[model samples]
Target: MNSLSRMLEVLNLFKPEQPVIDIEVICSQLGYTSASAYRYVKELSNAGLLVRLPRGYALGPRIIELDRHMTQFDPLLAASRDIVGDLIAQTHLELLISELYDSTVINILQRSGADEQALNFGRGRPMDLFRSATAKVILAYLLPRQLKRLFDNAAPGDLERIGLTWKDFSKAMLRIRKDGYCISEGELDPGKSGIAAPIFDEKGRILGSITLAGNSERFNAFNREFLSTLMIDAARKITSRIAG
Candidate 1:
């Protein structure tokens, strides 16, 4: 990797579980020489992206500042904020807005509801490409070449979760696109279900998805058809806001 790429890779090494990483671990994990690792650490620390800690290095205050800027200024988040709030108020279900970042899907915003079941997805967490309603909805709108690339790179069991073959997977995505929404049960989180619809940009290119999730039993008891319609309408409103 180039120097810039290697530096960014260092930041990606930090996670919720491994929040602090020492230079030794960075050197081992990234296959960098001790001197190179120290140089990278010094550069990152100077930029305020990493803070030295007794244990190691933790994400710095600049990350939080950047997050604040995104919350205030990201177009998708700004467009969906009020609409998502209204949907949560009306359906009393957990609402999530997820965005497609290259081949990965990540939840950008979420509002919890009455059901206390912990979700596997949250802000900044990656979603399963085949299992999540949020991810599936966005996948449905991906270009054919893009879809094929993901299909080719899919993990061993990933495609099997959705279909036995690529043709089957393509047909499944076609159905979701035709229907304008996707409903998934126990796919990401056991005992929870979600319905999602894709949001689009001014040119009608897919941007992301809005999902409403709740207990499986509650979803079964509720009017799924009506819920799907509501979700689609909300998605359209957000798309319009983006266009405007």
Candidate 2:
């Protein structure tokens, strides 16, 4: 990879859940020897994309700036807007399309197609995993260490209360990551339901997630199995279009 791409690649190693990584982990991603990984780490640190901790490198502020620039013109919005509009025309349910950001999702764009209250997450609304299907699905696929940090940060003692032990959470995340999708019921809001799946780029990195969501009654009126299938297919279609 070129310098810019390589820098971005290294930055990609830091997830919202796992913001810090050791030299070994970086080496594992690149399959490089310690020396090579160290060299790149040094270069990335010099460029301020990486902040070296004792055991791992945390993402620095530079990456946050880069992220702002990329999502300013989100492809998911540009490419999927019309398609999402058409889907809503047929389905009647609103769309809450979003891309995963650090431990959250910023709804870059959305389409409601319905004349009723238009539903679109604004440009900078910070959404969390607790109340968003897209956020949960993205969280399910996030790096384990990063997820742990989130869980710990959000609710330390509550994990056991919710039957969400670290081990159980890990197992669930593994399954979700394997399935590449999630169906959430009241995971975010009391009456809100959603189905979501990942969108990927050419290198198989998750670009973001797209979700189909509506009032519980409207969603319950439809065949969830079919809707889930459609959403998953749509995710693949979007990914393929971008990757192509």
Q: How many residue pairs clash in each candidate?
A: 0, 3
The lDDT per prediction is 0.88, 0.71
User: How does model 1 score by TM-score?
Assistant: 0.92
Those runs of model 2 whose alpha carbons end farther than 4 Å from true positions after fitting are 1-73, 113-123, 156-163, 187-189
lDDT tens digits by residue: candidate 1, 1-244: 7998888889989877899999888988999998988998889999899999999999888989999999899999999888887888887889899888877888899889778865778788986677778899999899999889888888868887677678998999999999999999888888999999999999999899999998998777878789989999999999999999
Estimate TM-scores for all models: 0.92, 0.62
- Model 2, position 22, has a per-residue lDDT of 83
TM-score between model 2 and native: 0.62
Question: Which residue pairs come into collision in candidate 1?
Answer: none
Angstrom error of the Cα, residue 111, model 2: value is: 1.5
Off by over 4 Å in 1: none
Give the winner by lDDT: 1
Worst window of 10 by summed lDDT in candidate 1: 156-165
